[model samples]
Target chain A: MNAQQLCDRYAAGETEFVAAPLGGFNLAGADLIGINLTRADLHSASLMFAYLSRAKLAKANLSGAKLSGANLNQALLTGANLHNADLHGASLQGADLRSANITLATLLDANLIEADLRGTNLSGANLTGACLRGANLREEKRTYSSSLTGAILCNVDLQGANLKGADLPRANMSGANLREVNFRNADLSEANLSGADLSGAFLSEANLSGVNFAGALLTGAKMERVLMTEADLTKADLAGALLIDARMAKTQLAAANLTGVRLNRADLSRANLKNANLTEAEMIETYCARTDMTGVNLTNANLVRAELSTAILTWVEWRGATMPDGSEYRD
Target chain B: MSVQTSLGAIAQTFAQHNNALRLRKLIFCACTQRWESDRTRLEQQPWPQLLQDLYYRYPNPEALGDAIFGVVKQLNRQGEYSRLAQIILDQLTPLYGENATETTQFLTEQTQFFNEETQFFAPTAPHLDPDDPDTTTIITIAANLNAMEQNLRMRKLLWCLRHNSWENDPQALLRIDLATLIGDLQQEYPTREDFKQALGQVVGNLSRRREYEAIAASILEIINPLYHAMFSPDPNLGDALPPVVMVMEQTPAATTIQSLETEVHLQTAISPPDLSEFPALDFLKSDNPTTTEYDLKTSTNFTPAQPPPALQSPAVKLPDYDRYGVRLAVMKYANPLRAKILAFSILNHNFTTDSHEWSSLRTQPFDDLLRLLHEEYSTWDHLVEKLTATAAQLEAPAESTQAAEAIAKAMKPYYIPSR
Candidate 1:
């Protein structure tokens, strides 16, 4: 059916177009609200600027479709195949995309706010500069965690997004605005978060091994028990961040600002803290075996009961610093 | 532009597009879509010269071969093909072959006739001679049906009507008057079907006078060629789709696009293994998830219809056509089969379940259907209804048939008979 015919029929209250062969169709700027096109062959179709809000397209073949600037808000796209689809700048706010195969689709600068994306396959998809604030990527019972492996999330504004236990290993999230993003128990290992602002982000118990946080703003971030082995925090601002019991073996913390940061009982073995400002940082009972603390400023910092014996402390400022011996450093 | 200028343009374009591969598509297109006489004309010419003529005639190989064939058809119908071909052959003898020239000289004597010839074709193709600012082109008023089609919303304004975009648009109109059924056509435009009907009515009325019949034919040529391919005894038509009045069977210009894969050299293409020239019906079938009524599972119980009387009798059948000719003609019907199926479904609504003689026609593989249509149901109007209804559906509310219709339209002159 043509767009106009479909619209006319919709006006007459007939809406189901299940499995329609509408491939290569141009429905640009059309208003197709609430249409049920389940299992429709929409490959290579152009729905650019089309209003498909609340549309039920579950299991639709949307591969290679051009849906740029389309408003798919609250649309049900469960089990839909959107591989290789270009949804650049499209909005899927509050949409239910559970279990959809969206692999390699380009969602560049798209608005996916509060969308239910549980169990979606987003591997290699470009979500660059997208806003997924309040979006759900949590692993629910009977539904696998949404896989975002190899996703390009560069400069994305994911503030307040719920990514609890989502598989996001190796995702590129450089320069992203991840403030208050819930990463509880999520896998973010080897992910790029360089220059990202993660202030007040609740990242407790997240797997952050091999992650790059160079020049990132992690002030007030909750990283309790995070597996941060081999992570790069070079020149990062982690002031007042909670890193209690975090695994920091071989982590690069060179020239990073950790003022008033808590590293209580955290592993710092073989970690490089060269030239890092650790002023007033609480490092009580922290493991510091063979750690490079060269030129590090530990002024007024608490290192009580910390293991610092084999640490490289050359040129480290220790003025008013509490030592492992329960006495203050006089220099 | 002069003949030399046109030739220079051709030569320049040829230099840029000298793949020799591009010509294979052009030649294949020409060989496929051309009328019998046109095909014969192409066959008579040497390959290099034919390549040059085709390039100079159309230029864009990527375009539909139908358009290329359309130009030749128009020229041939005007009886101008023989005249033009003889002159081109005589004058361009020195330009190609073993004794060829690098630079071509101006055909000064033929330039006048060429410029005059360019004027008649101005409405047909306004896209030529664009770079020549020094030349003054002849202007003619033509009915641009395309522009009129776009503004289908305007009540009677069948006129994209000088309201703009008319110059670039092809708009030379032959005003056919049915004594004033004209109905203020500029205010309330009729559907294209209606317009065609009115034109046919006007032309039919005027055909009584022998002198005006030529004008009548010219006006109707826009709606012509619907039955031309079927009835025009194109070379060795044989028993392959005998002349039926309304049957929209294979046309001479019906070439399958396996156009150029380098993989489809005639050696493999001619292998009579039902190679399924036009495949991929997965997208064409209406996969209505709500209804499993059209599934192929029901195809098993269907008893095949008895073979047609003509096929059984073998009365007055002509000599055998070469494999390529048979394949080309057979390939035409199968390609349009997609359009036919979609159009058929829309018309026959319960086409899958209906217990007609042609029951389960849609369920069969494209190859089987082609064989059935070729060997048995060749003369049935039920088969012919594919084209007619496909044409009619173009005017209907369902426009998903547009792509299929367009592909079919390009290969054939669209005519939905008055019924």
Candidate 2:
């Protein structure tokens, strides 16, 4: 049926429509609530502003369709192919999109709150400014996709994804793979990144106050000038990482890997770095007063003009290391 | 004798000059050493208290800042002292002036002194208190050591938890979080050895707690169902019996007693009963029995089946019954096959299940029943395709026939006269 006929029928309480020769049909602004057009061939159709709430379009071919401003609340689109579809400003709240193909789809400004998107293919999708708050994107295989805070991608993939400036505060990204991702200037306060893979990630100037990075991998990562007051980086791997000028007051980096790392000019007052690997690390002019660096590795490391006055350094390896008073470790 | 008195006076003057320089050097050395050793104790004291003590001791900010800088310089040779130095500088800056430039310069020059005295400072040098025991000094030392031990224990606890360090010894970390062993170590340890022992205990405790938490989390999955069942109120007490028990109690018998008795009596009463008295024997007498049997066999053998129905037969008709009655019948039957097919067609064709074609059957309340049937059909059709396919595959032919018969019967009651 043509778009006008379909709209007329829909307005008359006839919600269902089996479009004939369905390619490129423009149904913009049509009200087709609770329609079941499953497995229909609607390729490249323009469904912009369509009311498709609670519709069942599972396994349907809607590739390259424009569904902007559509209402698809609680719709079931499992295994449906939505490749390259324009879904901007759409409401997909509570939709079941498991195993659906949404590759390269544009979902900008969409509301997908609490939707089940598990196992859905979202590779290369532009979900910028989309609201996916509490949406389950866990184990959903996505690649090179961009999901921002305006996107509410809390508890989403972010694992190994480049999420520079993504506002993920209180996001349940615990156990997510965030290795090598850029988080510069991101607000990650109270984000659950426990056991997440953030090895070598750049968090420079990021606000990580109260963020939980316990058991997270931060090896070789740069946290320079980052606000990490009260952050939990316990057992996090920070080997060879840079914390220069970073504020870690009351931050817990206990048993963390700081081997050959740089903490120069960083404020670590009252911070816990006990038994941490500081082997050959540069702590020049760093503020570690009252920090517990007991049993830390300081072998051949420089502490030039540093203030560790109250730092716990019992049994700390100071072999060949220089003290702040022009005294060698042995002396 | 006069010459001896003059020589004694010259010797005394030289001794006094020599003693003055020696005393100054001794004082300088003693001050530097005290500064180096006092830092550890000073850190443990409250910042305000420590600052007050430093100010009282030096009276002059410049001199106090210089002493602090001197200690900083000594540790700076190792390159690891820069952090601590900056802290000291920041803390002292509010109290002391930017006149720290001189002290900074002196530190740079003295950096080589640390390298030269490498062997003099023993690694095992007992961190001892001054001979003149002061309560403040003792308290500060104890606090510093305690903080250090606690910090170490915390580190070890985190390490064990993260690495799954107790995988082989699950109880190791569990005890730590439970017993707050780290906090305890901070209170109990005095020496490095004591600290080490406390740390070990803490680690073991932590491992134990970790194990407990993991096990508890896993056990939650198993307990959830039992917990729900125990707490939930039963709505249907009559249907509470298990399905298998119901089936066992209602099993049907293989044969009826009446049929068995009839067969036995017939077999015993007559050895091939008299044919003349039988009602069917009269008709047989008029015909040739041998030919009749032969003709009947020939007719059965000669009648070949008509060609099988077409794959897409339009004649596979929907009954012209009252839509509501047929729908109600379908619902009552709860036949999934018919419901699925009907729902599929309605959704695919964009037609209501209550349409003329479906409601023409003369069934009761055709309209409402059709709506209900349509809903039920739609609901079932919404399942995943794989599940639908499996359901279709498992359906028996007899069940399909039974469903078709029910629909036909429901439609029969609503037939309208063709105009």
Candidate 3:
């Protein structure tokens, strides 16, 4: 069936288009709300700015389709093939795309608020500036289930997205824009997020143990109570960030910028902070036991009551910084 | 004294205890509600000191239980019972065995009762047929589900009130009417889909609101029924059965469910992941890299990006005997062939004669050996650059990243690090 026929049929109250061969149909700007197009062949179809809200496209073949700015709010796209589709600025809020094939799709600046993406394949997808607040990218129920496993989300933008409880282990999200993203309790262990821009992100209590944030921009990020044990934050920018009570045991923050950062009561035991900038940073009562802070700039930093026993502070610049004692480092 | 009056006196005593001069000023470090400011101090207190503090607050065991129960109730309003339970259990641990105080025993009994009752219903709906002749059973089940759902919703709302980032208005709590909420939930959830959709909304709201602890707690609620059914030694374990069973006799559904419980136990025995069974979120938050890595490696239920499992393919390898013993028998179609093939390809890529690749193929039913070969080669090629960099790091000086990379590379299946 052609796009025009489908539209006419849709207007005539026939919503079922199951297994319909409508490949290459120009459904651009079509108003097809609440339509059921399950298993439809819509490969290479033009659906730009179409109003397909609440539509059921389960298992539909929309590979290489043009769906830019389409309104797919609350749409059901479970197991759908949306590979290589152009979905720029599309609204997919609360859409069920569980186990959907969204690889290599262009979803730039899309609004996917609270979408169900469990086990969905978003590998190689360009989601620059997409809003995925409350999206479920969790693994399927049962042990070792298919999740966002092997998904390549390199350079994707996920700024301001709420990824609470998201399971993104092993997903490549390097160089992604994650500013102000809420990743509370998200499982990002072993995930490759190297060079990701996470400025102003809220990552409290997130499991980031094995995350590779090497050279990532984390300026002003609030990572309070985060477990970053052995995490490689080498050369990462954490200036003005809050790491209050964060556990960073043996973490590598070498050459990282931590200017004016708060580490009050934080555990940084045996952490490698060599050459890190701690200018005006607060470390009051912080645990720095046996930490290697060689060549670290501690100018005007507070270390009041902080445990620095057996710490390797060789060549550390402690000018005007507060010592573990009540006295100043300079004094 | 009344419970309220006694609670006030106890609160005042607790305040005095807080005011005792330690000369050390504590800092509030953790952000948001997830932080427990007194965690360090409370955890460090000796048993005698803890008991003295408790004695100062309440004279008798009943009073102590009452005080603790009051706090538990308050926490329960927000579904924050788990943390409170942990704190209470910690405080009462020294009282266990012959040294057990009357207060501790009462608290323990109350806690166990609370746990059993609260963990009554799992998130998954019980099997109930609407078409059953016994409408009474269906009605009872529906009523119980409604009550449970209402309780969950109320807790969620209370949590929302506490976690609301916007203007904190105390009036929000006043707006909730328990009766009205129960009435609303009682309005027929005839279909499981409707129930699931509603539950999804509740969880989605919790997630969006950044109520992560609540989300984790709710996940626990889902697993609680199964956990108790499989593990709890209580003979009266079935006392908390679905309301349907109370009204109706044991049927095929009940029998099948029992068998399913057994199956769950068998699966748990087969895999150690099941042993760490607090909830799925507990596993997620666990610091054990091996556990998380193992979990990541095994997850293969919905590989949407890849082509349908070559299980159906005429050329795919089908083992004459299942490798995982009882696990294979349980999961039925779970194929480890691909993971094995990928591992083999990675270790040994070069073969002088094509016979090595073909002979390794064994009973594999695929004529498209080239397709398999291409997939494995590309994965290896893609990983080579990263692996080489890691290898370089290993030579320079052993760093955490290099070690992590080596471990990740080892655990990674062929499908991951997708190109």
Candidate 4:
């Protein structure tokens, strides 16, 4: 069916149009609320500014569809093929996009709050500056799922998004807003998170090995038992972050801010800490054997019993800090 | 009986209804207490005063006959003679004689197509016929479906039957026509529990056909609105026409309908529609464990092979699927198709064009080859452009605009006009 016939039938209160062959039809700016176009061939359809809230387009072929500025809040797009679709500035809040093929879709500035995106293949998709608070991008266990692996998520707002156990390896998430995001048990190894804001994020037991956190903000982040081996954190901020029992051996921290960071029992052996800030940091019994601490600031830091004697400590500012020998440093 | 109570009771029986003002106006035009010149003036007076003027002023047989005849004439002109005919007859028989043949004859003669045998309009008669409507009425209604489809109430009834999917037991369905079904509804299930039990029987183990399952889902969708309207304890929506509710009110099941809402509310009480609120249709929602990805039903199934995990946090709030038909349809179709497409893609991963499995994937009836092609091509626009170029090469002379006009156009210096 073409756009006109669909609209005419919709106006006549006949909403059931499942599996319709409406490919290449330009249905831009149509009010098709509650429309049941399940499994429809809507590929390459121009649905710009269409009000399709609560629409049932499950498994619909929307590949390459132009859906810019459309309202798809609470839409069921489960298992849908949205490959290469342009959904720039669309509102997909609370939409169920679980297991859908959204690879390479352009979703810049999309609002996907509380949306279910489990097991979706979002490889090469652009979600720049999109708000995905409370959205679920967790991995599906029973399938060959790689949720957002290699996705471009620059400057995207992912606050409160549950990406637990997600496979986001090699994903480009630089400059993204990841406040309070759940990355627990997630595999983000070798991912570029440069200049990203990760304040209050949960990364407990996450595989952040070889991750690039250069100039990234990790303030108040929870990294308990996290694996950041060989990861770069040059000039990255980690103020007030909790990294208890974290395995950060060989990780870089050059010129990185670590003020008020809690590092209790953390494994920082052979890790670089050159010119890094450690003011007011709680480093109780943290392992720092053979680690570099040159030009590091340790002012007012609680480093009581921290195993850092074997580490290079040249030019380290230890003023007003509680040393590993139970003695307070006095400039 | 008091006139107001009698009116209210009669109003309850109206499958189709009108205001007291129209009834009063018909009585006014029919009443003979006022003369031909006095009708225009008498109609201006209030109904309370007119009621006194109509009954108290006119006690003679000639005046009563004139009033009844006038009302019948006006009602006949308005095409409402059949609806109010029984009311007039009931009122007249008590005041006049038992065998009021003159009024009956006059009433019958005034309206040509009254067809009092099917007294659907009679307030005293049962709202639903004890059997299905005659074949002629059904056929006539079927013939002019478009015209009759304007009546949503009628259409919903027809839709219920169409979506019920009687193919499993065609004989059973054939024997149970619409009217007969409604009539049987009066006697078959005395309580709403029985109705629900029958629905469970129908929904749980009905049929194996995919079409039937789809139809069942739609029927369930239709039932939501139908249920609320039919079993609503109070007519709170103020809907002008409520034929189903009216029919239910006259049946024994109506008494049990008072608690049906509470029962439904309990089932849907827990979570909002994370994906959908069609929990009752769980059979359709759940992925069949026995089926492989190739066996998955919906062509829309782009589902990952992975089983769904629990929500990481309780902060995620979702809208209910029962909020609208679109949500319901989404939820209904979301069931049972989560793991197949990935399996299909994996099976076709080797991409051996000459292989039997690869050929099967292309020829499989349920498989979406276009989508697979779309995924490979990246975008349909690119595919179309490539096809158009190929077509250009094939039909170069017949279809190419470039060959027709652009060949002679001048090539200006700064004008690469690819635009």
Q: List each candidate's DockQ score.
A: 0.00, 0.03, 0.02, 0.01
Worst 10 residues of 4 chain B by lDDT: B245-254
What is residue B200's positional error in candidate 3, in angstroms? Answer: 69
Candidate 1 lDDT over residue span A1-331, tens digit each = 7766766787788889999888988887677899999999999998876789999999999999988657798999999999999877577888999999999998875668788999998999988756677788887752488899999988677778888888899999987878899999889999999988899998899999999998799999999999999999987889999999999999999878798999999999999998788889999999999999987888889999999999999877788899999998874
The runs of at least 3 residues in candidate 3 whose Cα sits more than 4 Å from the true structure, single-residue gaps closed, are A1-8, A11-13, A18-33, A38-51, A58-74, A78-147, A190-195, B1-419
TM-score against native, each model: 0.44, 0.31, 0.38, 0.43
Q: Rank the candidates by TM-score, best first.
A: 1, 4, 3, 2
| i-RMS of candidate 3 | 18.7
lDDT of each: 0.56, 0.49, 0.53, 0.56
In the range A17-136, model 4's lDDT, one tens digit per residue, is 899999999898798999998999999999976889999999999999988657798999999999999877577889999989999998765667788999888988987656687899
lDDT of 4 by residue, B96-184 (tens): 22122223332222122224323222121224322323322222222222112112222332333334432322122222223223334
lDDT tens digits by residue: candidate 3, A1-331: 6678889998999988889998999988799999999999999999876888899999999999988657788999999999999876577878999888888887764666678877677766766445565566644454423245445665454556556656666678786667787777667777787878799988888888878988788999989999899899987889999999999998999878898999999999999998788989999999998999987888889999999987898877788999889689764
Quote the positional error of residue B125 for candidate 3 in Å.
88
Reported per model, the fraction of native interface contacts reproduced equals 0.00, 0.00, 0.00, 0.00
lDDT of candidate model 1 versus the reference: 0.56
By TM-score, is 3 or 4 better? Answer: 4
Between candidates 2 and 4, which one is better according to DockQ? 2
